[model samples]
Target: MKKSKWSAYLAVIMASAISCFWAFWGSMENFHEGWHYPTLKENLTVMAIQYLSFMLIFILFSVIAILLPKIGSILYFLIGVAFSYWIFSTRSAITLSVVLSWLPLTLPLLLIALLFWFGEFKNRKLALFIAIGFPLLICCTISIKMGVRVSRRFHDGNYEERIVKGNNDVTLVWASQGPGWPKESIDWAEAQRRCIYLKENGKELADTPQNIWRLPNIKEVTSSLTRNGQNCQGVWNPEAREANYSFPPDKESPLWDIYSPIIYFWTSEEKDKDNAYIVVYHGGVFSKPKKMRGSVGFRAVKSVKNR
Candidate 1:
């Protein structure tokens, strides 16, 4: 009976440790990369905050498991089940490989819970091996790959340009690029905030004025397009209008050339009570609400209003 009780305690400890490690590792890695331009002090502050937050959660989990072993094991099992659903729900297109990859992140917690609940049944060693081994392997492999990719982008000069001065009549300033894949993309409101930041900060050039720039209207956004080489079409909806870049890009539009990959931008035009027009540089165009979030970007336009 002593051995049995000890197994339950050990299982609980292992489960908490592995779960905390996975959570901390994933959160820190994404946090490090998302705000890529943070100074050393800012980065350290963020890390400290994240560490404290996760550590508190970890302590709570440990206490629960220590005080109520059976209930804690059940809770851990439920968490694992919920996480399985979460992994699939987050996928843009679910497939076998995606499901398989996500399993490593959650399976260990489930296995540890099972061990605690059943008191070390047959094949427990195999279960333990799987619980511990898979996450470590996957986490290390992913970390190395992420480090390499970030380093390559740093050296390749692929960082998005912050400000691009257009013709003297109007100036175009770049907005948020967002946190890349597997995260909520910059929405229309956030994009607008980026523009406001630039305008107030002189577009990082030390001389630009503030409050003159604003989110461009549908007409103004369309007017900036230069159909230099390819056919362009004006796509209109009841609430808004957009110019499609078609299959070939407009070599003339400087904005299009820079953000050629995913040049979707939000316009100030409103579509009904909620939706607004979004201009796409490559994948045609459509409208969505200001609250709707996606990978859309924006360019703040500034000019003297006609008298």
Candidate 2:
């Protein structure tokens, strides 16, 4: 068709190729680090399948934007930016959810999209400003709204089972309302290991949920369980109002009790196959799984506010 259109399509192809190459390099290295050795050819084949599948969506989307000019390139840009940013930031597997994280990446690209779609720099300054400003406004506003929602929910007794803390190491409160650790029997061994890890890493576990601790060889996690009804079919703990009650929907929640209050999460401590413990809230639970591949979900603990 148009020479300009051809140029844009080439650019899209080049960008996609570059990104694919980068992902390939990174994934290969990460696999080596994780496996403690290089990947076999079979593993490489599978990883190739996974990687190509993951990169294809963005590449195809970019192709479409190149092929069509009238259909709202802003949307296309959103797809590109959000997808690339999430891959760069979180480096999640090439799954649909990670693909969706590409929404944020749309901002800067919007300017390019406008340039390509309109072929005019007449209002470029204003358009570029809007492009940059839009995503920031959306992200910041969404974050603030979520914070407010969480605060309101907590005040409404939703998180009663969780402990909250300030960034300044406020004397920790066990999930005050629920049956949390006895405080006297706070498995000191696991706590020592975790402190050692943190000290060595020199990294602080901020307000993110991962900061929540599951003490090794500890049983405090059992105390965090609470059922909303007499049936004990795994309802939110009434005392859990203080906890960041991210419990899945009832239909999605599995039926079990004295459950670790969480399931199937990566623990800071792994003891071979059958036994290990994971964090629940800033190092709170410390439940010892009776079996490997247990499904005790997880949540993080972080400062109430980063400030």
Candidate 3:
């Protein structure tokens, strides 16, 4: 009876350790803000959610330890392995994904497996030590590696040169296309406000008159074609072109590649008091109601006086 009780206690301890690890892993960002009480107070909902998740994980592990050690161990182990495999399989960079995603997914499962094994092992104390010690070593190792990689990327000058500006009045931010694209989609009012905010914050366009940094009309948005070359200024409205008709770029619309990330941008042209036009550089143009939202991005343009 004493031996069984010792085994159960050890299992609970191991499960507790795993649950704690999961809690910290999931809530590290929220917990980071807790260093400032005001920030924690401001993020009360997030903090509450983090705390709730931790408690739920703790309860789940504790129950599994007590009632269904063997089955629970296998279940969690398989879950962890499957999750880790899925992450590694889908990732382009396996080593980075293993450090950043796989271990977090599987570490809890490993702990659960060890917890169940504790009851079955003749040397329960040894099993307990191994379960706790091994995961700690892995956690420390990955944490150090991830920190170093992130810090290196931040310090590297390569990250600074993301934006590519054209000879035209318009310029594309580095997130102009492909991955790392901006995910903001705002209404005309909000879009105009954001442009104003950017301008006021000294992100003004060069060689343009003051107050010229505002949202472009449909015509102005289409003016930055690669075909326009050095003369890509103002809006370029196609003659009687269908709203959805997207044509291949000649010199007239060479901007299709330069602004590839521009899936949709809010144009200053208002369809009504509530609806507005959105320009899709490659996909064609469409009208969006004030209420409808999308993953559209915008670029600020300024007109230049001819030399």
Q: What order do candidates take by lDDT, descending?
A: 1, 3, 2
Q: Which residue pairs overlap in candidate 3's backbone?
A: 162-174, 163-174, 219-235, 220-235, 225-254, 225-255, 226-254, 226-255, 227-251, 227-254
Model 3: per-residue lDDT, tens digit, 133-229?
Answer: 5444544554455334322221111222133344335554322221122234555676665555443223433343345345666655554433323
lDDT of 1 by residue, 1-307 (tens): 3336556646755765664575557644543333243254654465446433454454455446555556767877887899888888888998989978888878876876665665533444454444444444644565567445433331223234334332223335433233211123467766555555453333342233344445676654544454443224333343433344333333234444332223466877666767777866443457777786545656655543210
Lowest lDDT sum, 10 consecutive residues, model 3, at 152-161
C-alpha lDDT score of every prediction, in listed order: 0.51, 0.36, 0.48
Q: Is candidate 1 or candidate 3 better by lDDT?
A: 1
Return the TM-score for each candidate structure: 0.39, 0.27, 0.33
Alpha-carbon error at 119 in model 1, in Å?
4.2
- As a TM-score, model 2 comes out at 0.27
- Report the candidate with higher TM-score, 1 versus 3: 1
Compared to the true structure, candidate 1 yields what TM-score? 0.39
Q: Indicate the residue-level lDDT of 290 in model 3.
A: 62
Ranked candidates (TM-score, high to low): 1, 3, 2
Worst 10 residues of 2 by lDDT: 248-257
